[model samples]
Target: MAMTQAVQPVIRPATQPTTPARHVTVRGRASFWLFGAAACVALLVLLPLAFTLRQALGFGAANAAELVFRPIVGELALNTLMIVAAATVTSAIVGAAAAWFVERTHLPGRKIWAVLAAAPLAVPPFITSYAWVSFSESLQDFNGALLVVTTAYYPLIYLPVAAALRGMDPALEETARSLGLGPWTRFFRVVLPQLKPALLGGMLLVALGTLSEFGAFALLRFRTFTTEIYAEYRLSFDGSGASMLASILMLLCLVCLALEFRVRGLSRYDRMDRGARRAPARYHLGWGKWPVLASFAGLTLVTLGMPLGMIVYWLLQHGDAAITPVEVSLPLVLDATLSSVGLGLAGAALTTVLALPLGLLLARHPGRIATLLERIVYLAQGLPGIVIALAIVSLAIQALRPLYQSAALLVVAYAILFLPLALVSVRAALLQVEPRLEDAARSLGLNRWQTLWRVVLPLAGPGLGCAAALVFISVMTELTATLLLAPIGTQTLAMQVWADTAALAFAAAAPYAAILVGFSLISTWLLMSLFGKTAVLGATS
Candidate 1:
């Protein structure tokens, strides 16, 4: 009953599935690779728990109650939560408003504003902490910490919200307006609701930023859990106090994970499909221009101007005394840089490798397990580097004495603390790749392994590279974790800078701090360039 073949059907061999057993054999090999990747990821995630179980479980009911129910603990909890909430709300409002202005409103010179908004990300919170510490010792309080962190971390919200606004459909706004809604009302009701997910996402990021903040809290004399944990570790040496504190901090992070899952429940970020984008009409600032300009300039002066000026002023005042990068021996500089780079690269590579399997698993076929894995990453991500480092110290000394203070432990901490960056980038990349391409490869007689290698790997290579670069940058700049777990002889640049500054050798620390900032700026530039170049180019056109 089939249609008759025309012109003798250009006869072909009937061997499409001739090797059915061969396909099965190929699948077995492919599955082997899949399992290998999965095993690696599992090991990365679970290895710390294996060693740290004793420390985590060591908190008896008494210790748990003290940590959870003590007045001091309650005060710290309230303070930290206040900071998180305040920072989250302010960052979301500022970042989203800035994003909306640049991406939607007829704000002039948006490109400049966009760059300005993102500039804060380049300034390390610790350096900014140092700046504020030098700016005013007495300004070191909860309010000061909140202000500095909000100013520095708000960019997290800005970048994401900007993208979302630019990608949004202005037709919705037009619909509300046509229905007799005034501009402000339409914005608050229609536009704001549409931006809720993006704003929520930005708030989550800001909340996490505020949660893990250590340097700022330390400088401000704010006894957030991070600074408190560091105090316990340094003051008590090898004690259960630090561990108990870290476990509590971990629970705080879990709460964030729970909120994100609950609030964003079943809400896909990919709500706006293709063809949903419409350029919003620009609003002329008119007589409000001067005020807006002045506001931007003032914020810029306070946030950017004050910090840089203080650091420079102090450096120049010290002259030949404090700035010692030039005075230090070449080998010391070389050694410090090498150690930092080596440690960072090792961490980045390991994290990137693990992120891939975890990312692939989540992207290709997500389930409860994959979701749990992702939540674990996010929870760990919110932990301060100091807490994680202390936990690592406790675990290594007790359960894995042989590995204590080894480079391996340092790398392990880095992987744990910064895995979220690599995971985010890898998962994002994998999701962007269409699944149909793999099926098409199968139709073309390629087995899963062949298809993954030929199609998937190549497509994901760039993103993985970027992820590694990001992790490397983050690890290189990280201070507390490296200080804790680095081998006794290790001298990373960050450690060197901290040591110099701790000793009041400002000149000595300058070069390392400057170099650290330079390297971070380079990587951040690359990251933004990779993501924002198209937007830039489109604007140009």
Candidate 2:
């Protein structure tokens, strides 16, 4: 009886997990995962970078001299800058004010506006650009790209900035407003300054996105480093030109990183404390509501409605050009869907898990190394999928030849390209965790790991999961890298879409396109669930 009781008590302790270490597990990552992820990232970034520099240098200073001396570089540079500038400026104006209006104002349908602003994000920028190119005579060139991208990307600003504004204590704005400050003055003086970092951070995402964009630029015939690089690679088969263009892109990416830092400054913008949430006061949108509605309506019509309507219209018009399920092959579509979903989920989890370390470091250790690593991530974000794809190709062949041209290699590419997204979200969430709570956990006989798992993680865990889901959805839609890096015999929906479209079989491409959009919408719905109910918002123009 004594022995039985002792064994039973021990079993209970094991089951109950009396300590944090006993309860939490840090295992599950295989050696292949750790070494593979690290190796893949190194190979994906370094090899292409080195090879690209080699090719760029092979221009023997004469070609580069021509590049500098000629107007080609200047024209491309000006165009690039113009698009980025327009996208950034438009996104800032629309996103910031909309976030402010929704979060602070007593505007009827604030919830509705919040949903509409974010809805555009779900409609891929390229898809929007595609609609503009096909339908509107005026929507082309630099302005069209800006309009398309801004509509799609502005949500990046709205979501975070609105969240920030919602958590902001109304006391600051109220205090400012009470001091004889008019509406415009108080907003400019108090709110704008306060939201600067958030605004800039969102704008940085837009800028990098514009820099790395390929599909929209290709569709619109707008020349950019990414589009040029791809054209050189696939169309011309000129690796030299591709590398040269990629080098320019890298330079642009570095500039974007510098700008992001300048905009974000040194402040940590995430404030996810569990304390009582204070809501910002609204600026009554009485007379100003018309301008708000007009601006908002114009954007919603062009950005949201027109693109979706175009997609639907194309489907209807081409409906007679019906692609039988047998013709398109549901099995093929299923395979692509499964591949996309599985890899997207796996990559999202891996990237999110990997990003936790960097995020924690950024939150706690803001030293040069941490800053440098963070900068590297942001710089990587500006890299086109094709560049990352080409880099991985070189690295895979050289480093891990056995793993080369495998699903594992493709997943690694996805992880590297999308890791930064997970990092940003994790960092954003980490910024919200207070050190005091962690210190309190330590006082309760917990070590750093214990404190993180028991306290910090429990609080930040939701954000991490949300971040992972977001990554998964994005990778599922990713076309460029998947096109180059997906091993032989691997067929993804993105590749199928590209192939069908390239073959000029719009009817054949319809199923794949529909499937992609369906998946995108579903994934988007999942993501919006994190914030709240967000539906497609707009009126057709």
Candidate 3:
């Protein structure tokens, strides 16, 4: 009866769906810009590779083949492969064992042992070579190269593997135990498979480091592709030969990368259940505790104790000297230290900035394009510093004349060389940030830029810090690129150490080396303590 009065139902205006469309538009623009930025970064890193290829191609097929297939090339390749293989295997064993002891067992002083285990990374491989060479000339061969690199880089494996161990759910191990699996059997069957991604990534880095190593192999008199490439560049000043060699080196690195990627496959290792994870129970060492303690003690002594002891010993020896060629003056040491710190900060900041776009694209918009860009950036890791430096020198001389012989150019080289380091850490950090948080922020009417600036940046800050710190440590110890690209009179600590060491002025080099090592130690401690279980070396999947 009331409807007869024509009481029409009050209709609310249709809610506008413009918000989602606007969000989509903003996100689409952001992704487009991110792809552009990442593509630029990847192309910048590809310069060295492209240059090397061009130089190699300039040689006709016959000449290229001859250069590549010669006995010297074969010998260098053999030496490179042998050392990379041996060092990778040795590092894997030591790293996996050390991580297991520190993480899975109730070994006394486990925390101290963990720090000690990772501390060797603080000492650069070249510095380790110097220390070992100073300790005994017997170390100036393949065995010495093996020991030095293994010690310096095992921590690359150890850090990531330890992080994996810490994060792994214990339910699988418990199930294995219940099924009558022995410790060794369980580890071989279950734990090892879970460790594949981390282990493969670590091994890839180890192989690449060994492959591209120049300073360490040079100091040790080991003639790998890197050292030989350096010699080619130095002697001829014509990059044709060097580029050919670098092409071979790059080929080897690509092989390692491809194998690692293929072997890593698509297997996901995360836990299936959505339950709060408890810490894995530590195995009691019991009567084995004494032996485990002794082993860790020995490992620590070799990896950390020896390097520091040698550094200090050299410092004391230098202090007692009367007429050193390069006088180890307090002012000189301080100046070099300041230069190193300043350059390190610059390089770290610049590299992290350049790495951000690639990292972001890979993290949020992964696809064939993003994946290819990431691979291209990672290819820079395979480039020897000398190669990258020379490429930059050529690029600068030809086109960027203003940047030639400039610190800005050197910093750019650092960015190109270490983009992978920063990208890995940055991507890892971003992956930990839940995308839902960004979505929630958007739902609250925040613009895309606002969501990123307010929510994503804050969440990713620590990882970015870690990335910068990692790059800082690397740039501090970098030798080849610094040697080529440093503005004249810049005088970094690494340069000072290289100069003195090459001149056989070990005493003069000691002060610089000690200061460098000290900075590294402090940084390493911070990374381990502040970023607990964070894999600074990187991870796969």
Candidate 4:
């Protein structure tokens, strides 16, 4: 044993080879371009905030404080907050209930009812207000405003909630039932909790929309911040006062978003079961079916049918001469239609293009920078359209005088206001594409750009299309921005309708309204179609 141990080898610790510390900076052309473009968009979106802050500060703090503390400011804030709270709650409840009836019950004509319910979204709030005001002078106050907005926005909640309900796993409900839970009990305790995200998202949209709404509140003679902002710009020419109000409105928007996130917290609703699951059983309304059907029918009548019916009635009463003799101003109508279409297409294309970089960045490599940029863009979206329009107006007059009152400037404003819509849609589409497919493409000798171009784009085409259609419809129906920034000679259908209605020219307004509704319906159909059968039916859950 001594002889065998005589030559034992000494062991040393293994060391990783110390390569020279080279400064390796790996960069891609695509990544560089994406980040740069995203940065530009974020700046573009933040310009309004920057200008508003500058203007608010330009007026001495004491002066700004005085402006904000006025009775008008408090009144505007109260009106705006009340409307936002009411509209969001009413929209969520009506939308979710209607969605439940359509998706989870054995109701007759569910398909038709679902389509009718969503059709109200095609009727712009202003147009609905116009219709209601024409039909009855009584619908011009708080109740009226609440009714119109609820009808107009409920579809936002309905679409997402319906989609969520459809996608939800049924086993949870089955398990609850097995534990002796009744249908309504299981729904409230089990299903509603799962719907929190969708409901919250839809409610957020509705709240922001009500905050930014202009024409409805204006026509209803409600003194919300939006109407006052318009008055300050148009009548008093008080830019500082308007800016002060906008700043307040912006703060309110931020608060709403913060509250939403706080209430939502960190809840997760993913299914734990790995295998395929069965569809949840639908509820049979049994003897309650007729009442449910009547409810939907009445809702459809008020939300969709009323506006449409009134449009027809006005057209017949005032449009008889025009309808019989074809004396309607064809050229003006034609020009306005063309203008609307061109602006819509331009806004949609530009917004979608701008959305791509942010969408891709957020989807692929989310970080603080990307998240902050996205949030900045959304802040602009949540601000009233008039605020963005006024900001652009002030900037154009100050620094870009030559561009003032140009159609291009108006398009930029549209892009600024609606870019969030396209961003959300495109990001959603990007999320659906599996990264493995991109990896597979790379393994086949394709570069990243080529992989994205050929594989990711095709997979996300439907969503992109949906984004375009939605933006187009939104631009078509837009009013406040177009009024303030459209070129001297430019006329959109929305503008025409607004002007004619303001003058009590119901017949003249009818054609523009009809055409506007037509385009909206077409675009809404496109949006719903791309989303899938239940896309607008509320099955996205």
Q: How many clashes does the backbone of model 4 have?
A: 7
TM-scores of the models, in the order given: 0.86, 0.76, 0.89, 0.89
Clashes of each: 5, 3, 0, 7
Q: Write the per-residue lDDT of candidate 2 for residues 1-541, one digit (tens) a residue.
A: 9999979977986676545554233222322243344344444444555666776788667767765556766788888888988888888888888887778777676677777877877666656665665465476777777777888888888887887787666777778877888878987887777787778778888888888887777666688777766766776554656666777877887788787777667765454555665555666778888877777777678767887776676566543353332146568878877877787877887778777777777776556656666666654576777777766665566567897778888877777788777877787677777767876776678866677788877677656766887898788778778777777888876666556544444455556666677777887787656423111110110
Ranking by lDDT: 4, 3, 1, 2
Model 2 lDDT at residue 137: 45
> lDDT at 171 for candidate 1?
75
Candidate 1, backbone clash total = 5
Q: Residue by residue across 434-536, what tens digits does model 1's lDDT show?
A: 7778877987988676887899877766677678888988898888787678888898877776676555566666666666777788888877665453334
Displacement of the residue 200 alpha carbon in candidate 4, Å: 2.0
Error of 3 at 203 (Å): 1.3
lDDT of 3 by residue, 45-80 (tens): 987678778877886888788878889888887898
Report residue 395 deviation for candidate 2 (angstroms).
3.4
**lDDT winner between candidates 1 and 2:** 1
Q: Cα RMSD for candidate 3?
A: 3.9
Pitting candidate 2 against candidate 4, the one with the higher lDDT is 4
